[model samples]
Target chain A: MNDDALPPARAIEFWFDFGSNYSYLSMMRIEALATARNVRIVWRPFLLGPVFRQLGFENSPFVLQKEKGAYVWKDMERQCRKYGVALTRPSTFPRAALLALRVALYGANEPWIGAYCRKIMQLNFADDREIGLPEVVSEALGSLDLPAQHIIETAQSDANKLHLREQTEAAIRRGIFGAPTFFVGDEMFWGNDRLDDALDYCEAMSRRDR
Target chain B: MNDDALPPARAIEFWFDFGSNYSYLSMMRIEALATARNVRIVWRPFLLGPVFRQLGFENSPFVLQKEKGAYVWKDMERQCRKYGVALTRPSTFPRAALLALRVALYGANEPWIGAYCRKIMQLNFADDREIGLPEVVSEALGSLDLPAQHIIETAQSDANKLHLREQTEAAIRRGIFGAPTFFVGDEMFWGNDRLDDALDYCEAMSRRDR
Candidate 1:
């Protein structure tokens, strides 16, 4: 398959949870990656807490698996270095993500979703700040020239909660068990590092159709 | 720190699950890696089923995430090709691992634990066969001129199960949630690909001590 032959690359739907460190990496890079590959990105923010609960997990997999957890922290450093992205471990993980998720969901339809999402991720991962706090969230929105009250108000609405729930269930149906998952047609790629491979697959599939 | 100034490398305890695909890759390459780096390797095999159960994962993460599952199969192909290893999807996944895990636990006292572990991994991953079946497990053992029954008997003993359980608990206590996990002193590297970086860490630590 050639890169130009398949249907124009479908919007790459990114289902992420704010508390996920790897998701932070993917959120930071998705825009540049999409532009380079001529693909579109759709941000879908959901609660990993719910997913983990359903899967019987009390915390992040890194905390559950000693060796894997240790590796991930170091591996994150390596990846950040490779990508030339600055990274500092978040002070408190599994942070209360309700507000951040609500904000992202509220901004889901805005033209500035990409910028807003990146900022939130950077606030937590790169800046080592608490993203769950209302004030921290408000400040991030204020810097974007977005009205914090409007975003928070929309996020707190029953409509938005239902919307978020539906998306989470949809992700479950789509076979997603973690944050930072991507799909192209029937193919799924998990983790931030797999972003390039996912894009390559789309490019290859497009070529094949041509 | 300079690489040569490091202290002598401490033995690496390799914790593996028989059914893990990545573990298969690591088991195959560990010897060559250990030799080149002059580090001792201690083979530790434990049951992933129990670990998963404890972590509340009913199946592989790939299976849980549809998009991820799709991407993983293809990615596995790409990675296998890169490593020049055969990549065939095993017919039976989460294969019955009782016998295979037992063999590993039984061989813990032997000098050939590393070599024997590698052979089983190749047989399961490279040959795309079921490692749980006695015939398949025995054939792999016979090729090494080891008595299959003796290994099986040892693996089935209460002592081995106790040992395996202890190791699993230790891993959990250490915050390990996945296979192919490596530890150098207190530094942890989680995946097979991270072997080089883990070795780099070991080299650095050894130098610092000197």
Candidate 2:
């Protein structure tokens, strides 16, 4: 069907935290999959650190659950290989996502937001870069051919920080406890593997509307 | 290919605890898939309760992470609908699998082991019965045309008690952290969704041997 024949586009809300390996998988793969299925993507960036705290976790649940943590690392390696993406294990688990997330939401309206999200994840999961620093995020913006200083400044503002906090609170309200959660309308799909299911939900809606 | 032309049969070890929701999902579906793919199924019953305690968990991880816990219940419903299984959510989460497992392992040599397993899971997950009770398990065994008294008595015997303990230890030694963990020639796959991947691994080995 042509654009006019298509249903009113229902964009999938992708809720992701910067520190998640599976979120990296979803970020790298969601765009192409969503584009092919003609589902628009709404990239919602937030920190999982605060969310984890609510679960009484001192750190990543993976860190506490050692054997599953071992499997997670292996799963990431297998996934990176399958997706043909280079990944060097980050020496640190969950570098504070506060800075990256603030800037990501700040740029949420910019046309390059998706590109920006992909680059941030690649630098974290692939290059093992310290994305917690302002410099790394500045470098990420520069590479995207977007202005670095202004976006960085706005992201650093107190209002934007509060905005990011609100985004996180909203996520908690949505009953999201993990990163890379997706929404097709009010229906929730969690984890990177559920990406297709989210898209299928969108496609099913389109068919129903038609 | 005919049976004579095929390689020696390869069995996939299905390691599960009766209390696990995903294990119930796997138990409900594994046999048909394995049969169709010409792969043998090795039913290995063990307790995740002991395993979780070793990880410092007082209860199911699903219960600890309430939001994710909520998602898990919904996911179970979706999985059941998809698989054509009747799932009346158990009144209690993570019922003690000790009694059921010991009895299950005692029947490991019997021809009706798989059917017995499927029925026990249905009683736990579909009928909302308290599987921790010996009476419930006896009822399940009676329905299966098996001798309940002999099996339960043998399972409660000191030899069978030691056998079940050893199985749980072996699961830990094998690096299994969760229920419904599948092993196709020592390559481990976790969760019910991975059932297909495990079967594929066995089928590929069959092709390679041929």
Candidate 3:
């Protein structure tokens, strides 16, 4: 049923964290896959820090459970290879997503945001670049021909920071517990593998609605 | 790449926990999918208790993270409905897998094991039965025309019990951290969603080897 080879009428909300390796999987392939299926994707970038804090998790669940953490690193390597995405394990995991997410919130309506995200993901995963640096983010924006300096300044503005916070809260209230969560209308699908299922649901609902 | 339509020269290992809802999902769907794809599945039933305890956890991570716990239950219902597998949440989650797993170890080489497993899954999920009770498991075995009393008696024997323990340790050593993990060759894929992907790899490898 190669849903990706369809008309993009239905829309789905996609939530991701820059530091999430699994999220990198979705970010790498989601746009093209969704476009082929004819589904519209609304990228909603949010910080995982606040969400984890609210849940009383002092550390990433992966780090808390060493085995799961080990599996994730291995899984990321395997998945990246399978997906044809260049991947090099970053020196640090769960790199600061605040700055990247802030810029993302500011550019939600801009087409360059997607490319900017892919660049950040490539930096963190494929190139082992530290995404926490302001310069790294600035460079990502510059390459996209977007207003790098202006967007970076606005991203640091108190209002944009709060917006990212509120968005993270919305994700929590909406029952998201993992990265790469997709919502077709209000129904959510978690994980990179469920991308197709999420799009299928959106397409079916769009037809039913019309 | 309809792996299911190919020759059955490849084999994949299927790891499962009787008490896991997600495991039930793979238990219900894997056989038909594998047979159609001609992939042989070596069912590995194991206990998650020792694994969790060794990681210094006194509770299921699902239970520890309330939100993930709640989401898992809901996801199970949605997935069951989608898979057309009758589902009724058991009164207890992560019901003791020791007794069931011991019997599974005893029956690992028997042809009746798969049906016995399906029955146990139905009892736990679709019937809302107490799988922690020996009688419930006994009844599940009875339905499959197997030697319920003999199996139950031997399942409690020290040797069989130890086999179950050794199997779990092997799983941990192999870097398994979750239920329903699949392994094609040496590569592992976690979660029920990766079942098809694992099998596809197995088929591809088999073709390459030939």
Candidate 4:
């Protein structure tokens, strides 16, 4: 019923990027829903920049398509209202997520990963802070009572950088072209709206095994 | 609680394209949901091709993004299963929706629009028939006991063609960039996932007024 008892593939693999707005919604809300369903979450932090590049775009689809970009901002407002989350439109879109992503990668398997991600998302989305800065990221980790400087240093190391790269490549291999994608077994569910559907699938699968 | 009693802007404006896979999902399920909520449905049929072209894309985003295209087909299968609807992979994608869209435009304000749209969607997504053909459209109308030849002729008239063009232009002006878009007084909700959300919003607004 808990993380330890569940099979590795039985849990939902949550692949997301720090810079993704919709990912902010999932990062904020996924835990409570998963816990209620007794489903475990495997946080997999990766960059979407490379994914977009591979798809022949140098920017987010929101940026590439102007009408879509406008609709997204408006939609974000409505979605935030519906989800009861605060949203301050980021002045700098797609802020350099490298540092925050690497740091999230540092805590991916830890209990603190969820807290760290939520903190980073709050900085970027809720507060409109430049989350790409080391100071911002450090402060977020420090606020969580973690050794901020040490974690940031470790996250920036060449080996961890390689880990992040491999993770993004893995996401591409899994056919992920967008953020906030969830995988329950081999079934992939994209977008924040599908989070519930993904968790439902996970719970159903677990029940079947019982 | 009926369509006559609801205010014009209070009802949900459903903008869709015949070729859009997500639109198929919404078209099939919208009526029952709308009826339950005592919300009126204003069907607005438009072509996405021109919208995509205006955004500088010559084809659907699904065609432009390969990984996304593959994911969409897979997602369609999952969505169809979840909705308890049959799905046969269309041998031809984006099959000339021009004719079907024009026909739907002719029935936009009519009660038969929903049935016509569902029939067209079934022909394309459920039955794997080439819905772009005139005869396929005629047969679909005939099955509904409507005057097939007459409707087809009227739908193809220059004036109706003008109406369809103006509708597509209207969609672009309204900042719509995707299919299965719903509007409740300028509140735009895009994609099939947001259909229920849109309906709920409509019902909530109606309740507040009462």
Candidate 5:
């Protein structure tokens, strides 16, 4: 099809929280996968804390379910190995991702969003770096050749903070109870394992529309 | 290799609960998948009730997490559609599977275990039948040409009941917090989505041993 007459690009809305290990897995790989399938990625940065609270827990389900928590770390190790990626056990499970998430929200539609998210995920999950610190987030942004300090200030602005909160609220309204959730229209797929299914669904929908 | 010189068959330990919808998904398909790969399935029937209690919930986590519970049912519909399986949302979620589990446990090592498990799962997830009823359990066994009443009697025996309880405790000790878990030795893979991964792991391990 000619550029002017081309149909709208297929898009998958990716809802993720930087603190979530599983989200780390999806964030590190979704870009390449979506690109291969010619699907657009709509980055949705949100906090899982509110969602978890609504689900009747003050902490991450992993922290509440001790055995499952242990299983997750082991599973992550095996999964990272299978994917040929790096994973280090973070000293703090669910390390503070508030600043990182805000930064992500600020860059949600920006071209650098994917690389920025991968860097933050790598810092938290692969390098086990303390990503809660402003400097760590700044470093991740700086590596992206973005205006780190200015972006951080913008992210911390009242309007941006409200935007992040509203985004998380929207996630809850959209039936998102966990991070690494993907949406091809209203079809929701949870977990990193469903990443492929989500993209496949998106591609199929685009084909059917065409 | 000659029969006497042949290595032991590759096996995957399938730990499932009769009441688990996800387990139902796995039960419906694991047989053909295992057969195609020449992987033996060692059925391990266990109760998720006690496991949930151990995880600090008296009910299924789905019941405890309202949003997640809703998400699960919807996700189940999508997943069943994707797998081309029939799914009728049961009248009661997590229908009591005590007797069914006991029966499955009694037949854990028997050749008909797979068929018996699938029948019970179909009753609960596909037909919306009350699997908790003895007659329902009997019907499943009868379809397999098994001695329905006799199997029921044996399944209810104090010894079989105790075995079922012990098996659940074993599941807890093995870091199993959910149903439809698979193990290729000490490596545990949880959920229906991990079925293929578990089988692959089993096959790979067997190859390495060979």
Candidate 6:
């Protein structure tokens, strides 16, 4: 088969947390990048809290490692400036991401996933707001013209919670120990900045298969 | 006592590998950050190749994890564009950094230390040349009007080799598993980007001591 006749690259899976500053940068850019590369993106939000706990981390890796923490803030600033995104250090980090993740899981099939993610990240980092606060989240949902009551109610359901838990376990099984992970085929790329390279690899694989 | 009259913050030791792309970014920027925050930066050059081998990694953590590798390359590109640093992926990675690191160690006490590091990184990443090449290194030294022979001879000396080894051992003992690690007082920060926060912590400490 001619390479030119091959199917285009498969969609990318982006797993992220609301508390991750780098996730904000990736989410903000993933659309444009996907469009440019002609690849689809699946937004997957998961609570990093459980992941960190399971990995024996009491806090963000940055906080546990001083230099890493310092760089994370500065790097976040740099990325935000470059992307024309507003970012401020959140007052509380590692905020309860459960509700947000649940909302995302239920909305996974919806077209509003990308916009909701961008808004939540901005609410946490750009506005320095507590994502765990119901008011703050409700405000974000209201802005999106989303049914805040329905989404929140569905997100808190036992079924969705179990699904989110199972997904986290799956991520761990796949060797993921961090937030902002991406997957192309069976390859797992951790961190937000890797989106483009993930897309490239997928494209390459598709071409090769053809 | 006035805050302005306080002693400088305790120095931070930065362990880096010249061959590390992220380390290059930190090395180039840490000095300015240190100066601004009234903190001293002690540059430590060690061999990561040996460390990786010991850890059973054949290459960078990114490469060992496919998803991470993709993100790192793309993220690096974005960072380079943001920092106005010219960069292209090196054709060969994990270049023999021993010679370059030795030279860096030899020049640690000299004023040319920063300039030497910047030039070497530029040559390797920006210019896409073999930094391990003796001629390339000599040219870099020549440009600085330094005695390339003397530096090279010193770097290859038994004493320097022992020092490098000792430093690597010290890093391992300190829980360092990667390049661009920094230690400020008892706090450890890993990765080049954390330099700013390291400096900030130093400044805050200085203020508190007053």
**lDDT at A56 for candidate 2?**
78
RMSD of 4: 3.6
Instruction: Give a tens-digit lDDT track for model 3, residues B137-185.
Output: 7888888877889989999999777778788888888888788898876
Q: What global local distance difference test value does model 6 have?
A: 0.75
Question: What is the C-alpha lDDT profile of model 3 across A1-210, one tens digit per residue?
Answer: 112232344888889999888889999998898888877778789878777888887768887778788778877776787889998888888788689889988887788877889999999988888788898998888888877899999999998888887888888887788788888766778888778778888888888879
Which residue ranges in model 2 land beyond 4 Å of their true spot? A1-9, B1-9, B205-210
The deviation in Å at residue B200 for candidate 4 is: 1.7
Tens digits of per-residue lDDT for model 1, B1-210? 121121236556678987888887788778888778877776668777667767777887766645556656776787787567776777766565777777787787587787778777777777778788878878877888888778777777997777777777777766667788888765667778677767777777777877
Regions of model 3 farther than 4 Å from truth:
A1-9, B1-9
Candidate number of the best TM-score? 4
lDDT tens digits by residue: candidate 4, B34-130: 8887788888889888988888889988887888898899888989999999999899888777888899988888878888899999999999999
| TM of chain B vs. native, candidate 3 | 0.92
Query: Tens digit of lDDT per residue, candidate 2, span B18-96?
Result: 9999999999888889888878887789989888887788888898778888899887787788789998988898888
User: lDDT tens string, model 4, A51-113?
Assistant: 989878899988877888988998899899999999999999987789999998878888899
Output the TM-score of candidate 5: 0.93
Q: Residue B32 CA error for candidate 5 (Å)?
A: 1.3
- Better model by DockQ, 3 or 5? 5
Ranking of candidates on lDDT, top first = 4, 5, 2, 3, 1, 6
* TM agreement with the true structure for every prediction: 0.73, 0.90, 0.91, 0.94, 0.93, 0.60
Clashes of each: 22, 0, 7, 0, 0, 7
What TM value does the first chain of each candidate achieve? Answer: 0.90, 0.93, 0.92, 0.95, 0.95, 0.90
Interface RMSD, in order shown: 4.2, 1.1, 1.7, 1.1, 1.2, 6.7
Which candidate number maximizes DockQ?
Answer: 4
Q: Cα deviation in Å at residue A94, candidate 6? A: 2.3
List each candidate's DockQ score.
0.36, 0.63, 0.58, 0.79, 0.74, 0.09
lDDT of 6 by residue, B63-173 (tens): 665545665776678568756778878887756767888888777768888888889988888888899988888889989999999889888899887787877776666
